[model samples]
Target: DAGVTQSPTHLIKTRGQQVTLRCSPKSGHDTVSWYQQALGQGPQFIFQYYEEEERQRGNFPDRFSGHQFPNYSSELNVNALLLGDSALYLCASSLGLAGDSYNEQFFGPGTRLTVL
Candidate 1:
């Protein structure tokens, strides 16, 4: 089966622009997590979704939003983008909620967003 996958591999937007990135989870996975990775830094958790509801969120501001579809696909939407928003957006798939100890995450190749 195919692992997690992200769309538009790369994107460019001006500051204040809005962008949406998509992800499709691996087979049989029901949860999805989004992360942002800046240059030279490890991925930072953005939010997580399970059963089509956002279950957890990290330190990101309100400008960052997301949704999970019934088919286990997800979309990460960022509004009023800023230069600081430029980063590699990652999507990871797992079998259960973040609280589940047995859940192992499989990450996608990531969508690279550049803000000018």
Candidate 2:
């Protein structure tokens, strides 16, 4: 049984460029959530996907978008990226939307994105 997973463990890009991050949920999980962790700060919620629909989002801007497939995997997209956008993009897998049933969370190591 694999836990959450992320791709392109590391990435480098110039400001104003676009980037896409990928994630696959854990087995038996149907919900996927994304977060951004700055150098020394805690993770900031980006958005969440459930049943192929976006059910929740954080304080991120419109440039940040996401998608969830029927298989429960997800992708995060950042357009017109900024230097500040550089960070560890994390993916978390849960049983369902918050407060649904399961509370335990599974996490991925995260994708490191650097915007120069």
lDDT of each: 0.96, 0.93
TM-score of each: 0.96, 0.95
- State the lDDT at 102 in candidate 2: 57
lDDT value for candidate 1?
0.96
For candidate 1, give the lDDT of residue 84: 96
Q: Pick the candidate with the highest TM-score.
A: 1
Candidate 2 C-alpha lDDT tens digits along 24-65? 999999989999999999999999899899898899999999
Q: Candidate 2: which stretches are off by over 4 Å?
A: 98-102
Candidate 1 regions exceeding 4 Å error are 98-100
Which residue pairs overlap in candidate 2's backbone?
none
TM-score for candidate 2, residues paired by index: 0.95
Alpha-carbon RMSD to native, per candidate = 1.3, 1.4
